[model samples]
Target: MAAVFATINNIAKPGCPTHCGINTVSYPFGIGRECSLDNSYSLTCNTSYEPPKLFPISSDDFEVYNISDSEVRVATLVSYRCYNQRGALGGIIKGFDLNLNKEYTFSVKNKFTVIGCDDYTLIGGADESYVSGGCFALCRKEQEVPNGECSGIGCCQASIPKGLRSYDLTLHTLLNHSDVLSFNECGYGFLVEEGSFKFGGAADLSTNYSEFVTRLESTVPIVLDWVIAPNKSCAIGVNICKGNSSCYDVEGGGYHCKCNNGYEGNPYLDPGCQG
Candidate 1:
């Protein structure tokens, strides 16, 4: 009889320095030029900053907040809406594209909701599918808002969907702020990080409202999923691993690596994990 273990030539092993805090950067992702696939896949941990910023794989200015094997989260700007005394509407916003074709996906899981007497806000725009939705708050008095509730009477909140790429928000006076103009003149809207916000008392509309105006500068944290390619497994046929390494399939149809038993360092490197 032939050898029973003829095809099982290699066994998987651990490589590279572990303990990258909460993050786990495996193959295809590297800390610097020496371990990355290219400049675009690199990550920098900035210890100088107060919260410890994480820079993009190559460029600066685009600060990274969190990264994982399959997903990443970044801080982004939200749009604004303002009106003049003559009743003309004007606003400013940052535009983003969620290119699924390019393998980048966007999501809106958190909401910066506004609550007041007679308010209407709209969050819209995602590719060609233009759909707009918002919340309405009506109340007889300001003291009715309970500790935790968003029932549209004194408070309201909306949940955004997953896989959303682009978004533009607009605030307006659906019923014409004539009734509650004394206490609530302009409504508010913002894209806040999920789980980091809570509903407060009705905005004191007379306090210059400058703080509310700054909502436009806020950014919502979004998660993205990345992959090497579709239908391409490292174990299929070609010997993708450089030397004494093995390949393992990931959740999204991609493949990463492991060193063949006694080696160390990164198997994805030129020399199979330095023993």
Candidate 2:
């Protein structure tokens, strides 16, 4: 299969580099190789530094922040666990990984959030069909947490399954924060990009887990969900789509590519869809 396209329209066929300061590069993601339509969506901008950086040759801590058409957002890195002063399981412990190899996944619209008060979180991916889930934020008091509501007390959320490619994040702390430690000692988790996150209180958590990992990049941003084709299935006649562009099959598998009626743009690139 291997077709997948979302050069996501905005016409990026002239030379690529559709903006950088605010991030925007529609055309199979792009950055080099004539602005990508291949090379597995290469991207690297790095304008020599000082506020000019985009990434995705696949790692460097993943930064980019938005890409749309099917989704792309990034930020990646946040997972905490803290408690000491005899509460045990003391300080530091952060983990994160996103991968995005099989085309893309990790966007069941996002969930799997967790915030302290005896936090309980464990993102998925060791293979269990595809994705996993976690949540267990218990609260005993601290006014019983109710600022933005994550639904397990201090905070919690879960739901992510479709065909995740990779996952990481593991933070746990049950009796360690020792019943909320006056106002949450430390315990955080990540995987957002669905409404951008909103749940504040418990003093926004800070018992010094290295200053809450420097604010988790302004609090999470990861959203991913892509499709167009890469063969998780589909073989038969093998049209795959071209000119008037069209294809089907997709749900947790592969095959997407569209653009018909009146036409649009990238449908796997070429002279496929226009208007």
Strongest candidate by TM-score: 1
lDDT of 1 at 184: 55
Give the TM-score of each candidate. Answer: 0.56, 0.36
Per-residue lDDT for 260 in model 1? 71
For residue 119, what is the lDDT in candidate 2? 80
User: Tens digit of lDDT per residue, candidate 2, span 1-275?
Assistant: 11122346755667666655556677666777677666666778777765566777756677666576667777746777777667887646666655567777777777778888788876778654445568898887887678877888888888877677788777777588875676777787877766777777565654455655556564566777766565654463235456787776777766666788898877766777978
**What lDDT tens digits, residue by residue, belong to model 1 across residues 4-117?**
111111212235322133344554555665555655566676668654455665555445555544456555443333343444443433233333332344445556465555
Write down the worst ten-residue block by lDDT for model 1: 1-10
Each prediction's whole-model lDDT (CA): 0.51, 0.69
Q: What is the TM-score of candidate 2? A: 0.36
Separate clash counts for every candidate: 2, 0
**Candidate 2 stretches greater than 4 Å from native:** 1-11, 18-51, 54-73, 76-134, 137-184, 187-189, 192-210, 213-215, 218-223, 227-248, 252-255, 258-267, 271-275
